[model samples]
Target: MSENARVTKAAGVVGAATFLSRIFGFVRDVVIAWFFGAGLSSDAFFVAFRIPNLLRRLFAEGSLSIAFIPVFTEYLTHHGKEEAFHLARSAMRLLSIILVITAVLGVLLAPLIILMIAPGFTDSPEKYSLTVLLTRIMFPYIFFICLVALCMGILNVLGHFAAPALAPVCLNIAIIFSAFFISPYMADPVTGLAIGVLIGGALQLTLQLPFLIRKGFYFWEKAVIFHPGVKKIGILMLPAIFGASVYQLNILVGTLLASLLPEGSVSYLYYADRLVQFPLGIFAIATATAVLPSLSRQAAAKDFDALGNTFAHAMKLVFFITVPSMAGLI
Candidate 1:
């Protein structure tokens, strides 16, 4: 098969899996809507969920995957598997340590974080406190997700797209189960949703583990905080982080504005955004995830022609797939 044909097939595989996952995600949201409806409790949960969800996808699915693949591909192509595995280990270990610290800080500072994030809730201490409580419960999810993102980066480089793409389906399934079976038992339905997040995060991580192991992923027992490859990834990540933050920044702005409106405005926007995410997650992200490794390999080979061709192919695919969805949403 032609290189372009091979790349297209991989993208198709990723897109198909991602599409399924997004469908389940929509179902999960429907379950949430049925049980929680739109109210102060739902608003609090949305605010709490939104902050971490933004960071989770940005780091795990967006910036981290984009940054890691090129450097990792270079290591694999030039330095051999052992050296590449060292790079992966170093990066994952450092990422793990950082996520743990961040999660801890997020929990400890939940009240202050809530004040800054959703200040409008201050007038209603119950809503404000519930947001804080849920935020803390969900903060540790950052740790599980960072590992999942790193695993996803590794798997994508190895041409293992299906498992990583389908991993998110586990998260949706966990949430759906919680909403239907667990939420009814909780005094606050949102608590059940919060617990589901932790469960889903673990499921996301665990689902990718065996695949990663099969790819001969070498995980370091100790953190290598200062590896050169990790440094390279960090340098690449800084600008990509800003670039990725555009979407999150928009959400932050929207949430700030939404908090000032009627009590349930945040919940309404949250529901709408979930619908928007369906296509964004399925098409745009799948293309990005599929294209990055191919681009990285071509760039590492110093084949500018193939590199340009791959990018062009990706752009065309993304444009054709997303334009209709964008129009429909509008």
Candidate 2:
């Protein structure tokens, strides 16, 4: 098949898988709404959820994947799969260390972090305390979700799109179950959601492991920080993190600013952003996921012409799909 056709087909599979995941996500949100609604616990949970989620986008799937995939592809192309796996293992170790440290700091300083992000919460001690408590419960999610991103990056680069794209459904399923079943037994219902977030994150990562191992991917016993591939990924990820995490940062800054608005503003924007994210989660990510593997191949083969065409094709698809969808949502 032609390159364009191949990319389109791959993207279709990813888009479908992502669509299913989003449906489950929406169901999870509805379950939350049914139990929590737009109130103190809900708002607190939104803040709690957004913190780790922002980091997930920043370091895991968003910028990290963009930077990691190309460098990974480069390694895979010239060095072969074994060497590429070596690079992946080393990169995973470095990423895990950073995420674990950040997650720990986030948990330890949850109250302070909440104060900084949503200072207005201070006016209501109840909300403020709840946010901190939930943040502590959920902060470790950053580590798991980021690890999921790393695994997804490897799968995507290996041309296994469905596994990464579909993995999110596990998260949605876990949360749905937590909301319906686990929350009743918890001290606070929102705590159940927090527990679900942790479970979902781990599940997302674990679901991909067997498939990855079958493909010969394995974790490195120790992190090789000075590995050339690790260095290259770090160099690329620094700037790319800023670029890739733009959406998450935008919403986060917006959320912080919302603290100055009337109460419930944070939750309103949180839900609104989720609505926008639905389509983006579907088409934009699908396009990116499919393009990255093919684009990496073209670039690896020094086929700039094919690379340019692939990039253009992806942009065209994204624009054509997103413009109308965003307009309709608005």
Candidate 3:
């Protein structure tokens, strides 16, 4: 096939798979609404769940993937694949250590964080306690999800996009099953959903292991977070953190405003935003997933012309679709 033909074919596959995943995800949400409905628990869980989910996007997928993958890919392309592998190992260690510490801290501070995020929860001891417990269970999800993102970065660099795109379906499937069969048996639906969240993350991470092993990048050794390449990741991540913080703060402001409106304000926003999210998730992410490694390749060769060309093409593609979609939403 010609280069354009190959690229087009690859994109079609990714887009098709992404569409299926989103369809399943929509079904899962529909099931959740049928089971949970719009109520205090649903509202609280959605808001509470939003916190970690937002962080997962910002830290795992958005910031970390965008920043870390480019650097990691650069190492792989230029310094030799072994050096790139070393960077991965080092990142694994650093991420493990940091996530462990942060998850623990998050668990410990879950009540405080919940209280601060939604002060209304404090008035109901039952809701407050349950939210704290659920948050604690789900906080470790960031670690799994972020590690999955790292694996995805590796896969992306290797010209593999389908597996990473498909990984999320596991989570949605797990939640859907749990919500239907297992949730009623649990203490409550919210508890079941939280458990499903954790299990889904495990499933997501596990799906990547076989692929990584096949690629000879599945060894389990501790990363020296201070390793040279990992340090570069850290350096890039600083700005990434600030950028994510600003974005999250904007969402927080929106949430706060939504909270002031009425009982279902947050829930309405959640559903509405989910629709907005669906296309962006499929298009932007699939494009980014497919293109990052290519751009990294050009960067590795210090071929700014190629990089610029790819960037322009990708931007045009993103804008052409996203602008009209946004206009539709407006």
Candidate 4:
């Protein structure tokens, strides 16, 4: 097959997987609506959940994927596979250390973060307590999901897209199951949901293990944190984070504004935000994921012409699809 055809095939695969994940995500949301309904408890839990999700997008999925894949892929392209693996191991070690620290800080400071993000919850002690509990339970998700992102970045760098793309489905399935079966047995439904998140993240991480083993990346060992490639990724991550974090910040702003409204307002925003995420999940995200490693490889090879072409074509395809999607959403 021609290079273009090969690229097209990979794009198609990611597109299909993204579509399935989004579909399942919608189903998962529908289940939440049915089980939780729109209430203060649900509203508070959603608000709490939103905090880490915002960070997840800003860091784990958006920034981390964009930054890590390129650097990781560049190593694979220029330095070869072993060098790439070393880079990944180094990056993973750095990521694990940083995320552990962040998660610890998050646990210690969940109250302050909650106070800032959902001040309205302060008025209701019961709801406030519940939200705090849920936030603490769910906040560690950032750590697990970021590690998942590392594994995924490595997978993408290796041209292993399907399992990485499919990981989100496990989270969706976990939520759906929790809502249907676990919630009924639990004293508090939202607690079940929160527990499901930790479970889902674990499961998501688990799904990547076989892939890692298959790729001979399963052994756990440390890599030097100060490696040049790792340092480059750390540097690039900031701007890439800035570029992608705006939408999530927008959601947080919406949530903050919505918090001032009636009881179900936060929940309303949550569900609407999920709807918006569905198209984004498929189009922009899939395109970005499929293109980035390729772009990185091209960049590493100093093939700027190919890099520019790949980016332009990907941007064009995104516009071709996302324009109509935005219009339809409107």
Question: Would you estimate the TM-scores of all the predictions?
Answer: 0.96, 0.96, 0.93, 0.95
* Residue-wise C-alpha lDDT for candidate 4, range 1-330, written one tens digit per residue: 644555666777888998998999889888888877788778878988887787888888878888888788777777788888888888888888888898888878888887888887787778778888888888898888998988988888787889989999999999888887787788877888988888898899999989998998844755677789888888888997988778777777887777777788888888887888788879888888888788778887888988888888888878999999999999
Per-residue lDDT tens digits for candidate 1, residues 80-161, read: 9778888888888888889999999999999998888788888898899899999999999889888888888898898898
Clash count for each candidate, listed in order shown: 0, 0, 1, 0
Model 4 lowest lDDT segment of ten = 1-10
lDDT of each: 0.87, 0.87, 0.78, 0.83
What are the clashing pairs of model 3?
A: 90-223
At residue 203, what lDDT does model 2 achieve?
Answer: 94
lDDT of 2: 0.87
Candidate 3 local distance difference test against the native:
0.78
* Model 3 agreement with the true structure over 1-330: per-residue lDDT tens digits: 532333445565677778888998999889888887766666767777777787887888767887878888888777887788878888887888888898889888987888777666665677667768778878888888999999988887877777888988988998898897788998766788888888999999999989887787845754456888777777887888788788788777776566555565667777777898888877776676777777777887888886787777776777877888788888
* Better candidate by TM-score, 2 or 3: 2
Q: Considering lDDT, where higher is better, how would the candidates rank from best to worst? A: 1, 2, 4, 3
Better of 1 and 2 by TM-score: 1
lDDT of 2 at 264: 75
